[model samples]
Target chain A: MSPKGKTRIRRFSPVQRLFHVLLMLSFLTQGATGLSRMYIETSWGKGLASVFGGYESCLTIHKYVGIFMICWFLIHGLYLFFKIDWRQFPRSLFGPDSLLPRFEDLGQAIQHVAWMLGIDRLLRLDRWGFLKKLDDFLLRITRLPPLNRVSYLKEFDGLLSVITKPPRFDRWGYWEKFDYWAVFWGIPLLGVTGLIMAFPLFSTRFIPGWGLNVVFWVHRIESILAMCHVFIIHFFIAHLRRHSFPMDRAMFEGSVDLAAARHEKPAWIARLEQTGKLESQLVAEATPGLRALFYIFGYAAIAVGAFLLIGGLVNSPSITW
Target chain B: MKEAVTRVRLVYIGGAVGLLIGLAVILTVPVRLARGQEEVTSKIYRYRERVATGYYEGYEVSPRRARAILETPGIKRGLFPYGSSSAMVRIRARLPDSHKGLKFYYRNTCIECHPEQARNIHSVRAGITCRQCHGPEPIPAINHYYSAMNTIRRHSYVCAKCHEGATAAFASFYVHEPPAASLETRESFPALFYTYWGMLLLLVGTLAFFIPHSVMVGLRELSEHLSFSVPHTLMVGLRDVFKKLVFFMSHSFLAGFRKFSQKLSFFKPQNFLAGYRKLFKKKEAFKNETDNAP
Candidate 1:
């Protein structure tokens, strides 16, 4: 059959999707091998380690995969460099497209919380001059000096404005920014520490002997923390959210339903409309085979991640104690 | 075509870089293997006692308890005596009657049995006794059986026993025995010490924020999607308390309070009562209708 009509908006490019897959696979492998060594004394840990031939084999796999990931991380950095428009410069860095945190994100976070609790509805007023009323009330109460004809009260007004309407998502949400930065920070820290452990002789030459101990401790703790965040938080936001229950196939298929995208990322949609690029961004719907593959892969990943997470937690000192 | 060319260029560049790195890593194979062998050879005999101590500490069992476990029939006979080849041959030759006791007493001077250790650096330079350095009691014969399996590297806490001032001043973390070199003044390895604190802060700060944020967001999403409602009484009480607090803040209490209440219609007690009653009234009405019909 011919491809379906254009009802999907492109989200992730092919390269990004590829990176996501590789990263996911490597991360899972690392979690499995790393956690196995961590909880080696426990019977389940021993069992898991045995699957990879033993503790020694687990360490070897963890090391080699880690090295591969480090290389991949560098490649990713290079990919990003080549992708950026140097002519755009600061706009490419500081614009909405970038994942960097901004002042508005704080307000958005509060607005999100308010939205979640139904307080947004309570705060919203449909009458004219609501902004004026809010400004007057704030000025009367705080008695603070105005800020550039639009004080922090304007922020309150913005909050009310944002809350009154449906919460508009940009290209990246706060959660997505967090997830991106976590990996960005985590990869270098983990890679360096892991390399130190991998080549002790070289590392010890530069670092004091006890620095190795500290490195090992940080590596383990950070890994556990990462596992907890990804399996619980990342999984929830990406696939388990109410709107995206079962799975979000955007990353898998490189596009999202136009209607869903419009609802979820109104700001992005509006920008696209303004630029008249929405039509070009639209793609034919994913084939059934592709959808099936994604579902199978997504569910499998979730299962593996959950298993590793639970296994690690169960054998952790806190729970075991 | 331009995008394709850029992609091709990226692929070539990435491939060339990857090949170089791969080759570099491959070149290190021999060196790493040689280094590995050297490490094993060096550590095997010199720090056998410390390694054995680490192995014992891994069990987290008391010496008395370990003795009891080892004393069980068929187990003690199966246990090996020493970790190192030198220790096995020499210890067996020197301490023929030593295996008689199950209790490990550190009082035994290790140098007497293994006098070769007297020439060791700590002994000759520092005038440190084998008993003081390696504990007064060596590990008992029963526990020595598992010393061969002491693969986990352990830093010696034995150093801290004598270096009390350094331990007290610099060795704050009790995760393992502080490495002897680490117990210097802050000026020594200041960077590593600071990095250690920074790592700790990062770990704590990330977990502290992310875990709670995740949990709260998860719960909120779940609750909102699942349509979980707060208890009616609790909700009402909270609304009342909040209104009262706001009333105290208002310049004119009665008028402001009236306006505020008027503005937020949901704050009206009648609305709350009506909703609360509606929720229960259906169940009550159904029960009454059934009862009356019967």
Candidate 2:
């Protein structure tokens, strides 16, 4: 067979792409509804509330949207569990060689900050170097690392080595791990507080007279934190980063251009190239059942959207000055 | 793979059907569960009875009927007399003495039971007796003592007729200005009860925010034991708790502002006033110098 010299950028499976689209829409709706409620006294708040019907209707939609968000979180978690290769999964989490920051990563971060401030030129540390050095140093000093590392660190120097080495599918990158933990912690804090606010009866059972007030406080503070995190960290990494400006398609298209991947995730590119066997393995790993599940969820989401739209229309309050 | 596709299609159809049904049910269920006509009438009658009893107990009276009367289109204008005189009082005074006969006659004569109250009535204006407000004929079926007690209870309406203002009835009756000893005896009991209830709601709501979840659950359960007849008391407690939680959460953001202010007294009123005064003096001085200059 003739060697195909062109680098083939693998696209996201149809299911994964659909899931990403739905997830983004759900988050956007939630953010709009939540922000509207938070600033209910303002003109923007009134306009947003009117879009949902009225103040009370906006609140009702906010509650249901919250429930929807939680369900999405659960589905996403299950997808990670069922579809993602378990061997590849843990490496993303503990793989210091990827994007998981170490002590040296802090220096790189500081250097980048300085470059932004025009104090110094941007540093060109290797993709895995700073993070890998930090992970190794932390693991050596701590003795006890993550559960994934406890089993694999004996054979491998650290998660960095495993991720950077050949023969493993590089589809799941280090950035995915950072995003995972960020969401994992953020969702629970917001979810529990949100549930309390939404379900007053349930909250009152435990919270006493001040249950609503307490829920309100926690909900508002957590919301502010989540918004700040999304605006600063998530925005910076996803769009505002030097090379990723305009957009990064890896999150939505679930694929990166070879040149961009080489520049941003060089270790991942090197590992994939060294292991000629990795491509076939990844292709084989894609299951029809996973695609089927995505279709099911997509239909479910459409049904939910239609129901909400109908309910909103029928019960919409008459607006008066 | 084909089988999976078929399964997905089935699930999708099922989800759509289920959602439609759910939406239909949610929209209609509240209307269906609403009380029927007979039930609604009985409930309204019961509520009226409760309000009548509450009036005798000296609880704050609702002006629902009066409000309804006021809201009726053209009614207020129609009721208003062409002359500038107070129509309400004139109409009441002009009613025939024969029509003043009480529907529910009282057995107890006011003079027999509340001799002091009778004396006070005479002292204010001779011939102006309890019967003026309580009606001429007393209830022959009920106890005379109960009738006299009812008269004293209903006297609050007379007081309210003159002294009405925003929460002024409760405030004046309970927390009297230039305090009246005669009024004090009658007012203090209701005042104490109202104060206790208001504080209880506020305190319970506040406490619910800090305590463990189980403790809140216990408080909710405990509310059932607190009330005698109505489940409303428990609901009120729960509602207050929810309000408190919301208040606590919302005000938490203000804690940042509080901390900031504590660390540095930015825009303190005293400091602001001082700066304003200094600026005013400087401006005055400049104006004086300019005036003196050629």
Per-residue accuracy of model 1 over A199-284 as CA lDDT, tens digit each: 75455444444455567666866786688778987887777554465678888999977777666678898998888888788899
Model 1 CA lDDT for position B43: 23
Compose the digit string of candidate 2's lDDT tens values, residues B126-214. 23555544444422211122332232233243333333331211212211111112233234233333333444454354334322322
Q: Which segments of model 1 are wrong by more than 4 Å?
A: A1-4, A124-166, A318-321, B1-204, B211-294
lDDT tens per residue, model 2, A210-235? 33333444555455444444443454
> Which residue pairs in candidate 1 collide?
B105-B137, B106-B136, B106-B137, B107-B136
- Model 2 sits at a Cα RMSD from the real structure of 25.2
DockQ of 1: 0.07
Clashes of each: 4, 22
